[model samples]
Target: MAQLLKRTHMCGVLRAENAGEKVVLNGWIAKQRDKGGIIFADLRDKTGIVQLTFDEGVPEDVFSLAQTLRGEYVIGAAGTVRERSAKNPDLPTGDIEILVEKLVIYSKAETPPIYIKDDDNVDDNLRLKYRYLDLRKLKMQRNLSFRHRIAKVTRDYFDQNGFTEVETPMLVRSTPEGARDYLVPSRVNRGQFYALPQSPQLFKQLLMVGGTDRYIQIVKCFRDEDLRADRQPEFTQIDMEMSFVDVDDVLAIQEGYLATLFREVMGVEIQLPLPRLTWDEAMERYGSDKPDTRFGFELKCLNQIPCVKDTEFMVFRNALDNGGDVRGICIDGGSKAFSRKDIDKLTEQTKAYGAKGVIWIRKEEDGYKSSVNKFFAPEQLAEITEVFDAQAGDLILIVADKPKVVFDSLGFLRRHIAGLLGLLDNKQFNLLWVVDFPMFEMDDEDGTMKAMHHPFTHPKEEDIPMLDTDPLSVKADAYDIVLNGVELGGGSIRIHDSELQAKMFDILGISKEESQKKFGFLLEAFRYGTPPHGGIAYGLDRMVMLLAGESSIREVMAFPKNQNAQCMVSDAPNAVDTAQLAELGIGLCDE
Candidate 1:
């Protein structure tokens, strides 16, 4: 017969209040020290860590077993909680010590390759490879726990607001209009494949048409796109959709959901009805649709500045003459923060975003120094200073290029400067809603109109007439919720009217047969009286990453792919047997 060991308390839960109380605890031995006559072990669980003492009072056999413990060995100890002589203020259960009388080794573990500490500076590849051991660290455990709490809070809040959690199929037809899909081969249906969903988009819309008024799903979405710190090939989305709701209705519900989430998970109260900005205003002022309003260093178009158009500086003159933009941002105290060499590095950074070069003006004690001082006279320099409202010890960085390049380059530079200045506060959470985006944006390579959000996004009712005449002038009833500078997620009031949907497809160069072939079912469903629906999908991983104060979504995800979209731990995307491929009517192609 096997002996069963029962746990009466977590390793970190016993405190001075529980002094002299008998308790049984089970956890991994974080660290152990033997002081000749006594042994002390720091036992750790998911909650936290507590000290266990094995002295002469303990049974000789139990004390002998406890002294043999190593860093991550799974063990259980039965003991009485007592006030510690040397209490640790850093830990929660630091005030108490467990006088362990009974000890049992549940399992033994080899020494971990990486130290199980929050500040362990191991290589990310090693961390991912030994993710199971990495997750034993307190920080990683808390992040996953926080993720769980957020998911629970989201489900509860949406359910209370009359939303049903309906599941959608994972394997579906490939719609390669947006991000590249991760296709799965179909063995039964030879030569055909099913692509994993980028989002539960069409199915949720179909649900709305089927009279499922309010739908919510915590679902996985796949995308074979480039990876980043905040992105993964496969991720979870807190997706929701509703019928007969406009922009305001969807925004209000989401605001309520977020408010509840913050209160429950973070214990921080967020003010209802977050700040809102229109797409044009956001882009014009901040040079970005997703603006980080945490700090100030807003972009100012130099077209409005006096003497800019009249200046002999060919950079500004040629830009204004050729219908390009000249924009500048005033970085306070940047004169000292960024040296000349640092400014050159920033100039190189801007080139990556399509800018020819960046012009920098430093406000000195006497007057001003500029990269293009030879082109502008002292009086013209003073005018430039006045335009940017420059004070002594400030730096004005300017970019002159086509509208998109100017915006992209300056926008990225602004954030980079903020990071250099240490002005971005991780503790401060700024939520914003950017609305009224253009219905279509011109693809730089092909010069063809592409849907700004997606083809399903409805054009502003008043701008429907301009779909064929001037598609670029049309605005979509779309909105994006931005946190700090990262875009959390976005959605738009979908085109429920069949004619409007067809017109949108036509504008995007989707012919009748192409539309039928790609989204024929969606079009067919829309013909059955679809409601005016709108909803948003929040990147659950990104949301948790922000909430947990992590720099990457991988910190919050259990198993994630590396930059190359390869799973180092599992070694996935491996070769399959030839018989399996042959049975599926698939053949390998020569590289």
Candidate 2:
């Protein structure tokens, strides 16, 4: 073996200015090319990649070793940085190349199952199955680096803001936070299980009660739920809680952090305070609380339009007669865009959101065309179009159903159409706070009221009186930070008063006994002196996805599970040994 080179500089740090300087670089070979007279290779590290040169002037042993270099071979090289004869304009260190004096092959790699290049068009499963190789790509390395910077920024900002970085228990008593809990069985205590913390919600609040006025933690949380592009069974949260604060106080703190983050990470300066949208207004205008404001096509209510209201069209009639709402959006210059087949596809998409069908009115050069043309005369259709403020070369899509269905269907339709039209720009960050959410939502299956956030969330002071009388009309003192149509984070003033907390449980149909059994500890803690505190938690994975210009959170994660929540690399959720299961007093059901 040759004498090893003591590392001096990173591959990406050497450029034309560092010419003639002795340097040592350690990295995996990105690619290697051998000309008859010389051998050139691109060496890559987390920072970036740089080119290395080996010609006949180099030692015979060094030249022979360089010739054997293959992709992903980890090697160390001692060389002098020199100006490159042919420069690559795209690379940061393109102006210079390394003239290898000595080389050591640290490790050799086999042919990777997947290509390491970012533009490699391969199936996602193959990429995930070989994640170690996949993460070697420059794109993946940059994303992970971006995530790290965000975490550092979060800690620094919070520390400067008087927040104490606190650690919370990962294992805790099972308490529902909307999703099913990922439970762990006890070996010591048979039949008892500890659930993973879905978020540091309760523990952070407890810290506030314990006189930790401000707390912050970048913590891991877990949930036993179905997965999607932006979700994982186990994920990290920028968890936080603060004492002596209202909704505005928490929002202000988050805004400061976000402003600092965006300016530093994305080089985008955010205006001091982001916009705020009331929940009711957002639903009515955009059909979504986390509405994307980058594009037009705001939803409009068609219930009051005379042609739509009094038309006697069976669909419209049933919706209005039953006190349901009818809402729509007009897409400019989309008249001929959606053909009958396209409209049918739109209907199929809306059906998943509980909408029976979609009604569209397209004003073409000739005349008005619609799905409801038979039910209404030509003039009436024109009147309906006029109400929607739609002109020729315009389209009006309407959903007539219950208010929930209308909002869900139309909200999704707007974003879907925007995507097709190339309007939702990932680089354009549109952030706002969605406030004044309803205190509770009705669960149709059992006709019961469930907390929109959690039972511990406090109701607005004025709305507290109405909670007993009209729970549906009451509002929670909660706020959600929305970015680009996604709920980035949310928090609320907690019900610190034990009496109020008990009342909340009662209203949610939890019997006093059931409440004591499930959330007895939280209720017990509330008995002590508790401060007025609120906090917010950001989905760190989702935040990185937005800033990294990636569509899926998997791109930003180091190791991510598939849609079925299975880790392809580790193969988790596999059967446990019978002895281990027996120790926990568990049994597996036969398939």
Candidate 3:
């Protein structure tokens, strides 16, 4: 028979004010300490922990049973709240203790593999395998609580702004959205499959077509892409869309929502009207579309530097002649911090990003020391030093390569150097909107134009003509919200005209038949007077991760798949019965 004990208050709810009042508490024993005459135990619930005391005044049997209480044992206690002999300044309910007169041990637990405290420092794999036990840690509890609060705030803010919460189908048709799809074979429809949505993108757009003026969905999304610290195979997105809106309108609503969210959740006031930068400007200044504005080591074009014209150095001259760029960043006080060996290590790191080599110059008291000093005369070095305004302790690092390689190599190097110097402050968040992204990019592998965001993104009105003549030069009316160097979310005004949508498909080399076969529903819906609509999807997992100050999204998620996309706790991605595969008309391929 199950023992039932009525509960009046949570373990952590008792305070000094509740002294002398009878109370019943139910929770797990966090720890137990027996001192011959009395037993003291820490009782913990989801809220927090409170100490329970069983003194000599209590019945002998109850006192003896309290001594046997071990960590994580579920118990119920009827007691009187009283002032503690020694107050624990660290805990919220530390000023009071419970004098237990009755106790019931509901369930006994074996010792947990991981400790039920913050800062356990257990291996990630072991913690994940015993996730339920791991989640009992205070840090994990706080992280999940923060995530819930954010979601609630998001809902309230959006709902108050007249957005309807709508659900889109999970088992959706697979359309190429850059990432590979996680496909599910349908047993009823033999040989046919359904793919989980990477985002509720098309559905949200269709909602605008279906006359839903404002829509929002906090939904799960799936992808088959490689994982990273901030990424997972399956994640959540706070997706939204609005009809009859321009770029400015969408930005205004999002900015307002963010301001409210930060203020309410973190109690930090976010300055309204966040800064904006064009994609070209961001790349030119920071060598990255998602620029980390927290520190300043902005890239400088060496060709624009006064000394490059007079230099006889073949590295810079050959790069310009071969249609490549010569770019460098001046690291403040880098000369004293980095030795020649450190510079050599940096040169090797650049090679990983496709740069052939890195040129380093150090400004010293006597003269400048450089890898290319032999190629340039004293006057040229002097002019170069003046160009960079190099001080005695400064170091200049340069890369000469094709534009893509130069930007990729130097941009990453800039961040790496900042990390080494401890210049990035995680406590500070710098947010900006990167707008006016290029409509298309030329794929290096196939030499074909691909949509930078998606084919549905509408090009700038004035750049529409360029689509026919110089498609690569056309800019989309797109925007991305970036925070501390990471892209938080992105969206663009979508193509509402059927003809323009078809034209976009044509530019991507999708034939009429193929377009009709794959995106026929969207095209057909567009024919029925689609409204001008656009929306953005924020990675909920990533957002929570940033808010909780966690390096990985897995920390915020309850049961996330590991780097290999395997669920450690459930041991998923396991083999199914032969009958199940046969039912679906599927056979294993013998490789």
Best by lDDT: 1
> What are the lDDT figures for the candidates, one per model?
0.91, 0.90, 0.90
TM-score of each: 0.98, 0.97, 0.96
Candidate 3's error at 88, in angstroms?
A: 3.0
Q: How many clashes in each structure? A: 0, 0, 0
Q: Report the Cα lDDT for candidate 3.
A: 0.90
Stretches of model 1 off by over 4 angstroms after superposition = none
- The local distance difference test score of model 2 is 0.90
- Model 1 worst lDDT run, 10 consecutive residues: 1-10
Query: Where is model 2 more than 4 Å wrong at Cα?
Result: 1-3, 365-367
lDDT of 1 by residue, 280-372 (tens): 999988889999999988988888666787776788888988999999899999999999999999999888899999999998889889998
Question: Which residue pairs of candidate 2 clash?
Answer: none
Any idea how many clashes model 1 has?
A: 0
* Candidate 3 lDDT, 1-591, residue by residue in tens: 437689999776778899999999998899999988889999988778999999989988889889899999999999899999899999999899999999999999998888888788888888888999888776888889999999999999999999999999999998888999999999889999999998888899999999999999899999999989998999999999999999999999999999998899988888989999999999888889999999988888878665675455777777887888888888999999999999999999989889999998888888888998788766777776676677888999989888989898889988999999998897888889999999999999999989999999999999999989999999999999999888999999999998898899999999999999888889989988999999888988898998788999989999988888888999989999999999999999989
Show model 3 residue runs off by greater than 4 Å.
Answer: 12-21
Q: Model 3: how large is the Cα RMSD against the reference?
A: 1.8
